[model samples]
Target: MKIKQLGERALIQRIAGLLSGGSDIVVGAGDDDCAVLDTGGDDHLLVTTDMLHRKTDFPEQMTARQIGWMSVAVNLSDLASKGASPIGIVMAMGIPPDTEVEFIEEVVKGMDECASRYGTHIIGGDTDAHDELTIVGTALGKVKKGHLIRRSGARVGDLVCVTGHPGTAGAALFALDKKIPVSQDILKALFEPVPRIYEGMALAGTGSVTSMMDISDGLALSLHDMSMAGSVGFRIYESRLPVLPDVKRLLKKQELHEAAVFTGGDFELLFTVAPDKIEKARKACPLTVIGEAVEKGVFIERAGRVEELKARGYEHFRQQGQ
Candidate 1:
């Protein structure tokens, strides 16, 4: 059977099952946004890594600078979801020998700019020669004891919330794929995403956030993740979903809904909070209450009816075969 038959998440679970860790590991694989390590101090260490490839990840419209910025931004998003502060990042680049030196310089400059914006820096990294341009970035951060948020802590009746807007990156990609003209703002949203670092920290500080995860794989897939991790279900409201004006105007309602559910690269955070703590979350961060956690099955209410939410998003291995 082909690898796609197993899918990306399944393959990751298979690999995670083979790995073992000691007591120093606070959280293991397939559990949270980032791996937690006990530092033998008041603060715990958080680590996450992300990779970007030219042919598969980067779009033709994005420049070298945007690509480099994105390489760091994605990893930082993981740290943000965990309520960790910026420590530093190390990057490794695989480049084609034919690439110009100026191109590399611009990419590095972009990486530096993004890291500085988020109060972090790229201390060091390694480079290797390859046929395609590939960037791998590892981000390190710290969170206080008893303050780390996990995806497994969500409880029944917790309000499902999301920061800023969802489906912008997905809408941008949809325009690109269709050869349609898009605004610069939309392109920027897709090419250079801003990780919600401050918002995440603020929400975590409120002590009301239960389960949280970054929405890199689309809203539907993210909800599924939280559901699986917490062993609970979600009931998302269609009326509460924050759809952008451009998306609503450009695509039909059905197309827009599909894009919001299945489009990836948005980098927003999906979190849960108890009903009593909803006011705390609202004051601490800018978020919209999209739904609530249920007792059993995941469903979405639209037009006064509810239905099962199918998991359909950007799966690397699954897309290869399609």
Candidate 2:
């Protein structure tokens, strides 16, 4: 069997279980991108690490600058989802000794772009020469006492809304996989992932949304994670899902709804709020009402039928063999 068959969570528990953590670690491994811990006083510190390799995370055709910039943007996307501001970044870069200095500079320049945009600084990290290129980043952010959004806050009868559309990134990936050169529109959506900094802040400022998370690992996985964490059920409307024209074409080609929701790496935000207060939230942020929270299990409304939802989003090193 292949690891992809096991889904994303099973794979996370499989590997994350092997690692150990310090006592002060409030949270480690699992759930919404990264783990969080209580920083001494009024702040909560978030730490997350993600890797980029040619075969797994990036394609060889991608430039050094695109690679480095995406690395920072993705992690910062995680931070933005939590409604936190970044403070520092530390990198663990693995490069072949033969790698050019000019290429490295491009990667750093990408990082710099995002860092300046979000007001975070890449403080320090380590380097190692490896057979393949690998870039890893661990970021630090401080969430104010009451503003940190977690997956566990969702409640039954809450309205499910998403920031931006759900399928652009997936559409972008599809284009890359088939070597389908993208149209100007698709290329921008796929390459430039906009972290929901403004949207998150607006949602956080409203003081109404019960729960929130970025749609990094696709909509299904993010929704599933929030449901499990909040111990509530979600009923997502398939027809109501905002899919880009490009993504719909991609889904039609695959003949699978899973292609739209199961594949990950789109860094939009998924969140829930009380149905009664949904109007207020709508006024506060630019989000689409995709679904709602339910009682027991995750459900999806497709065509006209409503059924339980069972699928995980993308992961590189989850399940290797069946």
Candidate 3:
């Protein structure tokens, strides 16, 4: 069968099925955000990588600096979900031979600035000639063995929480597509997403969070992912969702809901906390309790009615209209 027919997630699962891990591997392929390795230290090693293409990942309006920032941000988001502190980053750039040297310099500068902002640095990387501008970033992180969080530890009756506002990035994309005027803040949400590094570490330290992952693939799809990982269900209330004023103002009710649930690029953390320990989680980070874990089936409550939450979001190797 064609790869497009299999879709991204299925293709990943197929490839993961062929892989095997050594005893040192704590979390292996297709399981969590990062590969956790027990390196015989006080902390576990975290590793994650993400690739961005000029045509599909980067918007035309983004500057070279923003592109660089985004490339690193995406990988860091994965580290954040694991409640790990970043150690360093390595990026590989695939660029056209005709690209300007100054543009590349600015890109590296952006990468450096983003890394430094999160208490890390870009140690080294490689560059090669390619038709399209492609950047692949690999980030290394560390978390204490007892403090590491995964997507598979959530339990029934746990409170579902999310950090920061959702849909802002999606709304920014919508605004850009329609050529609607929006503030730079809204646009920045898409161009330069801030990984919740501090919040993740704090939540992990609190010992209240049960499971966690970044919402890079939209809220609904993320819920589905966590559900499958933990073997638990989620029932989130629509009214409890934290909607950005800009998003609400920009789109109608239906579009607003769609942007909030189904659109991606937010890069916020979606996690579950023990209901009784929620105060500790709240003190650790600014989060909104929008729902709770259930026995089975992911559903969203809207207007006092419940419906199945479809696993739909930004996915690679799939047609937009599909």
Candidate 4:
């Protein structure tokens, strides 16, 4: 079957099935945010990579610096979800021949600033000529073995939580599409997302967090991912979601709810915490309890009616409106 018909997630599962994993590989492909490797030390090594293209990933409104920052931010977000402290980043860029040198310089500067903000640096990278501006970044990180969090440890009664406000990025995208005037703060949510590295580490240290992942692909899709990983279901309440005030004003109630649920690119942390340890988790990081884990089925309760939360987000390679 064609890849589009198979879908991105299924294709990943197929690819993962063909690969072989070793003993030192704590976490392998298609399972979690980063691949964990036991380095025979107190900490495990975390590795993740992400690819972004100009047309698909970078919006036209983004500056050269934002593009560079996003390239590294996406990779770091993955490491953050695993409670890993970033060591360094290696970036590979595919640039068009006609691109200006100054623009490339700004891109590099942005990458450097972002990495440095998170206490890391761009150690090495490669560049090549391509038809479009393409960037691929690989981030390396380490986390104490006892403090490491993954997407599979969620238990059936754990509380579902998320950090920061949801739907801000989606709202920003909506505003940009509609040509509505929006503040730079809202626009920055999409242009320069802040990876929750500090919060992730704090949560990991609390030992209250059960499962964790970054919400780059919208809350619905991320929750579905956690559900699959932990073999549990989630029933989140719409009223409990912490949405930005700007988003509420930008869209009507229905639109706001939909944006919060389905829109992607937030890059916030979505995690589950043990019920008894909820206070500890809260003390470690600012989070809102949106729901609780259930035995089976992912559903959302809105207006007193519960509906299935569809697994849909910013999927690549699949045709739109499929």
TM-score for each of the candidates:
0.97, 0.88, 0.99, 0.98
Top of the candidates by lDDT: 3
Candidate 3 residues 226-307, lDDT tens each? 9999999999999999988877899888888888898889999999999899999999989999999999999999999999
Task: Provide the lowest-lDDT 10-residue window in model 2.
Answer: 313-322
What residue pairs clash in candidate 2, if any at all?
A: 1-322, 3-319, 215-268
By descending lDDT, how would the candidates be arranged?
A: 3, 4, 1, 2
Give per-residue CA lDDT, model 1, range 151-233, as digits (tens): 88899999999987787887888889999987787778889999988888888889999999899888888899889999999
RMSD list, candidates in order: 1.3, 3.0, 0.8, 0.9
Residues 1-322, candidate 4: write the lDDT tens digits: 8888888888999999999999999999998999999999899999999999999988899999999999999999999898889999999999999999999999999999999999999999999999999999999999999998999889999999999999999899888889989889999999999999999999999999999999898899899999999999999999999998878989888778767988888989999998999999989989999999999889999999999989877777787324
Candidate 4 root-mean-square deviation in Å: 0.9
Stretches of candidate 4 exceeding 4 Å from the true structure: 320-322
- Write down the lDDT of every candidate, Cα atoms only: 0.88, 0.76, 0.93, 0.93
lDDT of 2 by residue, 1-322 (tens): 6775666677888777888987766667875555888767987788777777766777565677778778888888888778778889988788899989898888888887877777888899889989988889888887876887877888778898887777776767767777876666655555666777667767777777888887777677777788778999888888877777766765564434655566666778888888888878888777788888888788887879987777467655465221
Compared with the true structure, model 1 gives a TM-score of: 0.97
